[model samples]
Target: MEIKDKVIEIIAEQAVLEPSDVTMDSTLDELGIDSLGLVESIFAIEEAFDISVPFNANAPQESDFDISSVASIVAGIEKLVAEQKA
Candidate 1:
């Protein structure tokens, strides 16, 4: 699957929703995901892409990774995948 689609699927699974329900503009908070769910989602993404996310759940604001929105998360993953392939 494509990166966007796969990411959406992962996020949706964490939110207990379907892929169709997840939008690029959707935020984790908007999806009703708590801190635990956000951490789970991050782990799922890392496993899915075989890339470590630079996220600090304890201090999210200080993290290099941007989890502000689904689109941003996808962009971060895409960048990480590209860098890994390099």
Candidate 2:
């Protein structure tokens, strides 16, 4: 699956929702995913893509990766994947 699709699936699993229920504009808050869920989702994303996410749970806003929205997270993961292959 594509990075976006896989990310959505992972996030959906964490939220106990279907992939169709998730959208690019969806935020973790909108999905009712707590901090622990967010961290778990990040870990899943990293493992799925075999890429390390530069996210800081304590200071998320200060991190290089953007987790503001599902689209942003997907974009960040795509970037990391591309960089890793380079």
Candidate 3:
């Protein structure tokens, strides 16, 4: 599957929502993903894609980190993938 698809799948699974319920612009907060859920989702994404997302002290809330929308999450995943490949 494509990056977007993979991202949506991961979010859907983590947020306990149907894949159709998530859109490219859907926010994680809007989907009711809490802090722990966000962490779990991030870890799952990292493991799934074999990438590590560096922790940033100034980054947005866990749920907000590139998770404001599916598109953003896909972009984050792409970046992580690139970093891992590098």
Top-TM-score candidate index: 2
Residue-level lDDT tens digits of model 2 in 18-85 = 99999999999999999999999989988888888888888999999998899998899989999997
Model 1: per-residue Cα lDDT at residue 46: 88
Clash pairs, candidate 2, are: none
> lDDT score, residue 37, model 2?
94
- The local distance difference test score of each candidate is 0.92, 0.92, 0.79
Instruction: Tell me each candidate's TM-score.
Output: 0.95, 0.96, 0.82
Model 2 TM-score, 2 decimals: 0.96
Show where candidate 1 strays beyond 4 Å: none
Supply the TM-score for candidate 3: 0.82
How far residue 13's Cα lies from its native spot in candidate 1, in Å, is 0.5
Error of 3 at 23 (Å): 0.2
Q: List runs of model 2 lying over 4 Å from the truth.
A: none
Q: What lDDT would candidate 1 get against the real structure?
A: 0.92
What does candidate 1 score in Cα RMSD to the true structure? 0.8
Task: TM-score for candidate 1, please give it.
Answer: 0.95
* Residue 44 displacement in candidate 1 (angstroms): 0.8
Better of 1 and 3 by TM-score: 1
